[model samples]
Target: MNVAVEGRIEKRHISLSAKAKAYVALTKPRVIELLLVTTAPVMILAQNGIPDLWLVVATLVGGALSAGSAGAFNCYIDRDIDRVMKRTQGRPLVTGELTDREALVFAWVIGVASIVWLAIFANFLAAALSLVAILLYVFLYTVWLKRRTSQNIVWGGIAGCMPVLIGWAAVTHSLSWTPFILFGVVFLWTPPHYWPLSMKYRDEYKAANVPMLAVVRGRAVVGLQTILYAWATVACSLLLIPVAPMGIVYSVVALASGAWFIYETHRLYNRAIHGHEVKPMRVFHASISYLTLVFLAVAIDPLLPF
Candidate 1:
């Protein structure tokens, strides 16, 4: 009897631990990390230095909750198609680790919590922007656009750009032209960043009946579109040099990273036009590294003595 009780207790503990991990996975922590990366740097730039420690923490926590809420809602909405796509097949909803109802409730709870947190700790503007971000991701991107249009990610990506504005609002409690330029950088960057993933998984998106650009258009068209967007993204990043009047650090990093990004996109285009087997994941990986480097410069440039 004692041994059976102990065994049951251990099993229950393990089950609870697994459930917790599933809940975390449902939040899509990696996506939240990317959002937070944009947030902190913008906050630094807004203040023209590091803001208060607590305000930074509060805003980041709020941003993470909001991004997590969006991710959870996305998982619930896409659960059916997620099951069909190999890349998303392991998500909590598809894996049966989380029920759609549970995920939906979690999304609401965290979504509301994020707004309240930002309002109390950061500012009203920050809170409002976060609310807009949640709604945009849930409705505009996921519900209205994702399946209906091949240009889905092009507009859906606006939700991802909100972190920059939210971070600026947190520090300055306002809006400005500089953050809008940053916003453009991200908006244009999204296509090249995400389309490659879609390209690599073209068949999966097709099987799921999602209208990703890669599925709707031929490979060469998608590649050409990616290059166009990559160039526009680089152009927008350079605009910050004069707009924010950024110094050498940001200017150099932006130029170098943007060149590398454009180079990778050209490589994709070259392969597509030549009718060779295109390795899109290389461009996809390069896009992430490029964005990271550019933003790293954004965060560091303001702190320099020169």
Candidate 2:
């Protein structure tokens, strides 16, 4: 009896440790960081300088909850496919760190709580938009598109793009052509941003049967699409200068960074056509830096001047 009890205690400790790691995985912290980056610029741009403290706090909390909830729900829904993918095989659901019913409950709890918090603290518009984003990501992107087509990221990008609009509406309580343009920029940026990462894991994606672009069209087609979308993203970024209150400093940054983006995409495309694989990964990593700096520039444009 003593030996059995000791073994049980050891098993319980191991189980708990695994469960903690799974919970952290469910949060998808890197994706959340990109989402927050998208939100901050809108918050900064909404006001000429910095937004109100209360609004920023509310938006951040609400956005984090919604984004985290979406990620949890995605993990729950994709557990089977996740187990097949090397990158996601250790996720909470896939590893049995959490049960399906438990994850469902967790997701809904966070989702409803986030919506309520946003509605109560932020404007109803922001709250509604957040709900729409949640629905788009969960239903349209995850349920409908992910398995059906390689263009999954294209439409799914809409869900991620909403943080900008939500942040803008949180401050202004209204939408504008400028926010829409920001949405377009992010919408176009998403494909190139994701495809390189997808290319890196194409074999994993194929084994998992996820139908990513890299899996469907092969590396050459994916590379071409990345280049095409990168060009569109750069154009959209440039369009913001006139409509957005940004000035020449922004133009200079956009021009230099945009050119680099295109150059990287071209390099990737050339490599892909030649049956090489590493350049896309380089372009993929470069894209994160490109967007982060671009949005940061937007947030700080007031101080930079024309």
Candidate 3:
């Protein structure tokens, strides 16, 4: 009897542990991390220095919850295409680690809780923006656009851009040209950032019948588009120096990193134009590095006396 009781206890513990992991997976923690990366630095910039540490913590948590909620909805909605796509095959829903009902309930619970958390700890504007982000990502991007258009990610990218406004609003309870300019920087950055990854997985999208630019358009065309967007992103990054009066650190890092980002983009374009093997992942990785460095500089700039 004692041995059976111990065995049952161990099994239950293991089951609970697995359930926890599946729920965490449903949150799409990696995407949440990237979204949060844009959050805190903007909070720093919004405060014009380091803000209240606890407020930063609260805002980050709420933002993570909100992004996770939206990601969960994406997973639930895309479970069909996800099953077909090799890259997304390991998602919790695709793997049967969670059910559609389970994912849906989780998304709603977290989504509502995130708004309440932000409203209580942050403010109404931050809470409201978070809710808007969730709605746009789920309704506009996932349901309406994901399968319907080659331009899905272009407009869907707007959902991701709201964090700057949310962060800025959290601090001041208001909006301004600065947040919008940073919003533009994020907006222009998304295509170049995402297109490379799409190019690398064009086959998967084709198999799923998702008409991504990389799947519908040739690599040469996608590469050219990337270059144009990359240049636009750089130009927008530079505009911060005048519009928001970003300091020397931000200007220097933005120019240098923007140049590097555009260079890698052109490299991909050149390879496509020359009939050489196109290295899409190089640009993909470079985009991540560029955004991280640029945002880190944003955080660092206001702390400086100059």
Candidate 4:
């Protein structure tokens, strides 16, 4: 009888651990990590140096919560489509690891808590922008735009840009041209960044009845658009050099990384227009590296003497 009780207790513990892991998965921690990557560097730039360590910690925590909330809500709303797509088939809701009601409740709890946390620990403006980010991501992007148009990511990407503003607002508690330039860089970068992923998964998107650009348009056209957006993204990144009065490190890194990003886009375009096997994930991974390097420069520039 005691052996039976011990076995049941161990099983219960294992079940609880699995449930906790599923809850964390609902928040899409990878996406939150990318959002937080953009957030901290902006805070560093806004300070023109290191700000208070506590403030940085507070802002990062709030930003992570806010992004996590948005991601969780996205998972909940898209659970049906997620089930239909191969890439998303392992999501908690799709796997029945978490109920829809539980996911919805978790999203709301974190969403509200994020705003309140930012308000108390960061500032009102940071909190307000976080709220807007959540609304834009949940309503404008996920519900209203995603299924209706191929250009969904183009407009929905604004929500992703909000972290730069939130980061700046956390430090300075005000809006400025520099942060807006950073916002533009992200805005223009979104299409090229996301379209490559869509290209690789065009069939899945079509199967799921989602109108991603690669599904609705020919690969060549999508590639051309990616190239255009890539160029625009690089141009916008250069605007920061002048507007932010960026140092040599940022200026050089921005130019070099932006060029590499544009080159990758052109490579995609070449493969598409020529009817060669288009290895789009190359550009996709390249975009991630480019963004990380450029932003790393952003974080390092403010501390440089020159």
Residue 232 of model 1, lDDT score = 100
RMSD each, Å: 4.3, 3.2, 4.6, 4.3
Instruction: Pick the winner on lDDT between candidates 1 and 2.
Output: 1
lDDT of each residue in 70-128, candidate 3, tens digit only = 99999999899999999999888877667799999999999999999999999999999
- Superposed by TM-score, candidate 2 places the C-alpha of residue 16 at a distance from the truth, in angstroms, of 6.2
lDDT of 2 by residue, 89-207 (tens): 77877766677887888889988988999999998999999899889989999999999999999998899999999999999999998888889989999999999999889899899
Residue 163 miss distance in model 3 (angstroms): 1.1
Angstrom error at residue 86, model 4: 0.5
Q: Candidate 3 — which residues are off by over 4 angstroms?
A: 1-14
Error of 4 at 223 (Å): 0.4
Worst 10 residues of 1 by lDDT: 1-10
Off by over 4 Å in 2: 1-21, 304-306
Runs with alpha carbons beyond 4 Å of true place in candidate 4 = 1-14
Assess every candidate by TM-score: 0.95, 0.93, 0.95, 0.95
Ranked candidates (lDDT, high to low) = 1, 4, 3, 2
Runs of candidate 1 exceeding 4 Å displacement: 1-14
